[model samples]
Target: MNIKIPLPASGGLLLSYKCTAACRHCMYACSAKWKADWISEEDLVNILSQLAGKILPSPYGPDNIGLSHGLHFTGGEPFLNFELLCNALEIASGFDIPSVFVETNCFWCTNDETTREKLLTLRGKGLKGIMISVNPFYLEYVPFERTERAVRIGTELFGYNAIVYQVEYYRRFKALGIQDKVSFDKYLQLENRTDFARNTEFFIMGRAPYRLTEELADLYPRYPAGSLVHMPCSPPFLRDWHNHFDNYGNFIPGFCGGITLGDCRELNDLLKNGIDLEEYPVLAYLIQDDMLGLLQFTVDRGYMVNGDGYYSKCHLCVDLRKHLNAVDGFKELKPDGFYSNLA
Candidate 1:
């Protein structure tokens, strides 16, 4: 059977995988250790042009254009490359793309003047909003003051457009009176909790499962390798509503890390021709029979199942992809670092 996203309603463009901090639970495993490869101006133009031509699969609001469909600039952190981010916003504006925003950890917000200056520049370049990341993981690297400053200034400028990714975390950080970077352990101690993973929202893929196993294992019951066989992959994988395209040209469907539907450079062609399951065996198995099917396929190819039971189907899925990725046979598992950075 062949499959395609048809049309994605919303998506993000990853400026780069390089970040100021390496959050342990990051879905894409973005870190400071990543290479400084960023999206080229030409590639950005090509992507935005193609995106500008696409119509939403489901229309919303006054315009049905995909370019205005919740498109945001993201990365290991979009703010890391200030110039590229500014260029991207300007280019999107040239294309008449509106409602574009940027996601950030606020690590660069050193003071009120700098923050306001940067925000004003981006807004002038057609930035519609900002999503400030605030959480224990980010608090481990960025000062809470910077995040607070960003929120305050951003809300002042963008009004309701400025969004705290998780206002709950913002409130918690304020209540704690956290001023600077702190270790996750120390934050947990201050919160009087032994674990925070159970309360956080993140996908168990990329470096997350491997790096956070200890924090999550005890909280959730583990199951043997075949435990998720009967479970089908989530419906989101078959839909194109929420997705991300990376600097490396891979189109990540439904935020399923390490899984690439195809190259975004040829996105129009892929959408027109549809994906041949024969070319993407991992996605094929997953679409046909879920993670269990993928496990069976890989096991036949000599994948060794670890003795430790999986905490969820997502955990097992990442484990299976990690093995397939290391083997270097599957072309669908992408960005290489998604698996290699598991350490």
Candidate 2:
């Protein structure tokens, strides 16, 4: 189970503290509804000021990409702050050292030519390209045309540039539109490479924090709370985060930080006024230490826990509400097979 991979050499940069669309399944439902515990643009500037001796700003004068240790711009929707995103990229470009990646929904990639042009341009200017995140749920709001356009822009326009494009399919419900899922699958299939197994992920968490309706808790028809599930989070900050809870209180790692499950003994001081109750609305966070993990998980590490087996890993503090609505078995919509080494 110890799938040791390379240490993350990059940082998940919070570009803009906002998103445009409010997808139902968004783990935190990350919209204008919340703000992350990030150093501000000014804070970044100050950090840069102190680290000037170690790094440089973008290759483009006053350009955003130049300055950084390596960085990835993810958020409510990093593209929302396209200008700030560009500025950050300029800063990275200045340093000319980091390989930056953007985790985007790809919705905007198709609508605006300016955004498209900027992404394409970044390919040459040290931009690592996009992580075109797609899934069956995405089809609800993300039109087929847009997802297709995103692929074209990321692969074709960027000239088959470096990109991640993680996709996940759900097969739990037979009610979801078949055609929409099919179209989405085909789109991701084309984007996947031979080495990579799947272009998607089923790692639960996002907006709609665990939706445990009476119907869903019936995984075995009679039993409730079902079985536990867990995934190991590979963020360098995991132990650091776990320690936060053990010594202080029931909590989450800063990397996957969301809601704290118990008393806010020490974390309150680190956060704004109080714990980030706004983003993580799960009651699981308030659970006792021993049972805190009943509803938690981290990504990058593996194991598929389900109704038959017990849950694993710490997921309570994070938002898993959306995934709680149903588990995916993904079959009829199989357009492509993601090449996972294990799979």
List TM-score per model, in order.
0.92, 0.51
Error of 1 at 100 (Å): 0.6
Find the 10 residues in a row with the least total lDDT in model 2: 333-342
Query: Model 1 Cα displacement at 33 (Å)?
Result: 1.2
Tell me the lDDT of model 2 at 118.
Answer: 70
The lDDT of model 2 is 0.40
Stretches of model 2 off by over 4 angstroms after superposition: 1-8, 35-39, 47-70, 111-115, 121-125, 159-164, 167-200, 206-255, 259-315, 318-343
Which residue ranges in model 1 land beyond 4 Å of their true spot? 53-69, 194-200
* TM-score, cand. 2: 0.51
Residue by residue across 155-255, what tens digits does model 1's lDDT show?
89888778787787787788888888988778877885644644556566666667766654666567887767677656446565658889999988766
